[model samples]
Target: MTEPQGALLVGSVNYDDAEKTMRTASAVLGGRLRRIPDGEVGKRFHWIMFQPDVLGQAEGIERVGDEPRWRRDVDARPLRIADGVDAATLQLPPLGYASAAEDSYEIFRRLRDEGAIAEGIRFQVSLPSPVAVISSYFSSDDRAAIDPIYTAAMRRELDRILAAIPHDDLAIQWDVASELGIIERASGYGRTMESWWPGDPFDGLVERLAALVDAVPAGVEVGVHLCYGDAGEKHFIEPKDTATLVRFANAVITASARELTWLHLPVPIDRDDPAYFAPLTDLTETAELYLGLVHREDGVEGARRRIAAASAVVTRFGVATECGIGRAPAGTTEGILATHAEVASAW
Candidate 1:
């Protein structure tokens, strides 16, 4: 099988759904913590490897785009614990999380190096927002200070790492959870419609993004993967018009990246209608749009109609599932990719 080149999912790192692929992987994830983190507090990503189908491309999800209201189960605990540190303290590597994160990345690194996914397919890496993590655990000042320090530090480390990597094949992404309206609500950070969710500690989110965008060494391109909330239900505040996209997406578009991937629900606009993304109708003219047209069971007919409908609104099209397939069964993800390729061909 040949590799797909035009902006398919490089791979999914964090699964929005809490479900893990195996009991062993789940045990490995659960083993890291001495105590569980609150549903509201944040945690790091699993080094989970998404088994790739050579004929497919993946989609992006913010984190958990659904399942937020499931009353916190006794079994479902938070991913980390209080370490008695201020927001700055939150940065000192959790009792066991960060080290595991690094170790986990090893599986992903090997897959890319060995061409397990797609030989020439572009691959990318991601992590949650340091600011979001700080805000979830500490106050605003602590959040402000922590993201910058981490941003500067991570930028330095990635500079060397990216330089050493084969940029033609690899890329990096910073998945900022602060912007995801649902996760923020659980963590008590921000709302969906508020222009700038007060106490919205992500002010540094933008700055850190800019710094990293500028600092990424040549040959490596950077992009952002944004999600509305952990799950479909978290998108509070009815989307009245395209203003939310105008406001939130503007900052992202102007930042140092060249790509913007968003979840697109099905709409009634005419397939021939000029008002394609009548909601995000006012997107800026710089980055590309990976119209999310697939979900757990969406099919080729539905996929083709919707993708064509969306492309009419904004052109630089890419076929994608509603979100990542990391938590979805490897077989389920395989079907999603097969459909994505079929739809892309139709477009």
Candidate 2:
């Protein structure tokens, strides 16, 4: 089979900071990458786990317990609207996504100017869908009340990121994990993923995410990362195949106002069979398709098997890991990057 030509870093890296992530990715992947993320480092490392700490600081929000919930060494805890406090009136502090992006962009700019990174790569910022934060942190009773409020707050953060970074050099990725949990009606990390909204939950999810896709203006590149929960380096539930993913992708493409720059779907490490990839034939969206088929455990040969399976249905695509590598073992990041380089040709 012909090798795929590009690679994508699906947000988080296990590096100490953004500078190391960017510099190292540039040195290893080089022209293979079209965009680079800030490694979602610091408190942002464990995806949306840091959000409870931020939300807990809001006037009307309080943590459910004094001690933090332990999840792979990250401090994650549920939140609730404080008694008799109007969720609507409680103003949330800055979510920190925008400020993180802004800080990282300065480092990205310096490195590019110094010839450490290439000229054409865009700085990618990955933000969680409002549902991800609300569902993960709040109770079902509180979700509807807090959904619109948190969404607006996230929009404000997006606006800040858009204003601070140059449009031509920016790409925004909306991370959609909880939506899949809802779609599958499965529990992730012991919590059931259910939508509190009335009517069909699938439609609600599609519309919610499509609005986020359209929120990015015309010049900026926008994409969606369709994920199964990546807690403890495993999916909350291993998908039977790509059927649900293809359906979701087609729905989002039809629902969105703007063309998606790319769409990424995960491929389980063991799924290198033709049946597992057959559903991709029904994927109607015309965007850069990226299969998250690279696995550090099996390296280049494993990626090649999944690539061969995917090639049976989709003629063109890019390569990435099943999800961010932030939770990966300490010494495995470089090997994973090298695996992508070995399987896909540099752009």
Candidate 3:
């Protein structure tokens, strides 16, 4: 039987603690997973805004209105600017990225040293693109003004990660979920991702992401995770096919100065049809392609169907969950990891 060349863990692993997440995933998947994340453990999943909270407390920044609640997200009430702050004149503080990266790296190194994790696997750090955070927190008017500052702040976090972690053992994956809403022009679930750029939305998004991809140094491995929002275990909008993903990937590939190490695209559980994978033919990047074909509901059988369909168009690929399994019910993580092992031969 034909098997996938590798397997990817799309950042989160749904564990309450980081140590358990690393040890468990390494044992089950072995060398198949080239990188492992901390399951986005503790407060990360819904609390992605914690990083922005650092900026909200800066000297010139003030909360304009009562924190506005995102549509339908009961727990999400994010800080907005009190009055317009000049984007050019703003002096925002460090967004607590270095501290966080250092803390996580400690755990990563411990596992590797103890022989829990195989040598040569990277400790993957998944970060949301600044646009995703801006779209989630800021009002439509504030997105453009806030974007540059936030992007710079996020880059500072990357700088810390680069300086602290060994380049060979690090992989940075940028999560690009919100950009899809803008590209598809779909009002994702209850929120609207206002496009701040003037020209074609696709061009704007590609430029934004390409700049981010280029920001990483050459020695460190970097990849992009293209997602349609994963909330309530459903996509914010179901992708009609892979055409949009292919377009975005191709543009980024052409525009980026540095080579991307991998590209991860989510596959909806029901999409086993070959047309869904057809647009992949236009892709010519040497980066490994990992399809989010493993679903908690269908396990190995469903993954095989999706893999077979994808193989018809693209000869080389890997396997992963459509999004992080952090939000999945706690007990299901091992089964999901086992499914990936069952469906794909590890790299």
Candidate 4:
């Protein structure tokens, strides 16, 4: 089969700043990357969970964690705690998605004008799915109650982003990690992702994700990053195969009203067997499929092996690392970027 057509940066590049991320990635990958992130600096790896803490400090919600919730080390603030309290009466203040996005837009515009970034590439903004944040921070009873509220709050953040940035130059990527935990029924970090929904967990997940996709305006590019988890650069649970991911991707694609620009799924370093990619035959979405099969350990040669295996099951695809490389050890960024350039030809 022909070599993979392109490469994608699944957010969070390991760089000192956004300028370096845009300039360096554009120089190396050039037109291969359809979108580029702001490198998710300052907050490190929290992603959108930082919104809640920002909201907690805002007017409406109260910050209640003297000690970490559930004895786990996290920076989340639960909006409700007592069982008898009313969830409906509460409304969180806006999470300031517009401000953050517009701030980045300034940098993006200057870079594009200065030829640091190629024309036609969208500025990709990756937001954590609502389920990921609600499950991580809120108690079980509080999760269902707070989910709608949090979901609405998050949509408002999206609204801000969409309104501020030019739709033609923007792409919104919903990062779906915790939902994978729910799918696999995986237990880790001293908690289990038991399905609280009355019916199939998959149904609940698809519904939530579809709503997220539809919330973005029609003119903008949108995508879903079907992540397992990225803590310590390892999945919360290694997928037995691609079966669950295939099911999830197909479900969301069929249910979504808007066109999906792309769908990304992680491929474990050790899983190059055709069995791991066999289920991909069932994926029928027109969105670009980016296999997160690149690994810094084995670099280009290893990525080529994984890509060869994936090619057996699909006619076409792109390449990426299993997850964001920001958490990767310092000083390894150049090698990782070079691996992408080496493994895949530019689009």
Q: Which candidate leads the pack in TM-score?
A: 2
Model 2 Cα lDDT, one tens digit per residue, 41-108: 99999999988888888998989988878765656888999899888798999999999999999999
lDDT against the true structure, per candidate, is 0.40, 0.93, 0.83, 0.81
Measured against the true structure, the TM-scores of the candidates, in listed sequence, are 0.58, 0.98, 0.93, 0.92
20-98: candidate 3 lDDT, tens digit per residue: 9889999999978889887777557553645455566676665545765443233355555556557667777876656
lDDT of 4 by residue, 212-323 (tens): 9999888899988988898778889999889999999889888998889999999999987878999999986666889999988888888888888898999789999878
User: Which residue pairs clash within candidate 2?
Assistant: none
CA RMSD of each candidate after superposition: 11.4, 1.1, 2.5, 2.6
Residue 100, model 3: Cα distance from true site in angstroms: 2.3
Query: Which regions of candidate 4 deviate over 4 angstroms?
Result: 48-52, 58-65, 68-85
Model 1 spans with C-alpha error above 4 angstroms: 1-7, 10-91, 94-119, 137-145, 149-160, 180-205, 232-242, 255-276, 279-281, 329-331
Deviation in angstroms for 85 in model 4? 4.2
- Residue-level lDDT of model 1, residues 235-310, one tens digit each, is 3332343444455556655774444332222222123233445655566654345555555455666666665556
Residue 332: error of model 4 in Å? 1.0
Clashes of each: 13, 0, 3, 0
By summed lDDT, the worst window of 10 consecutive residues in model 2 runs over 68-77
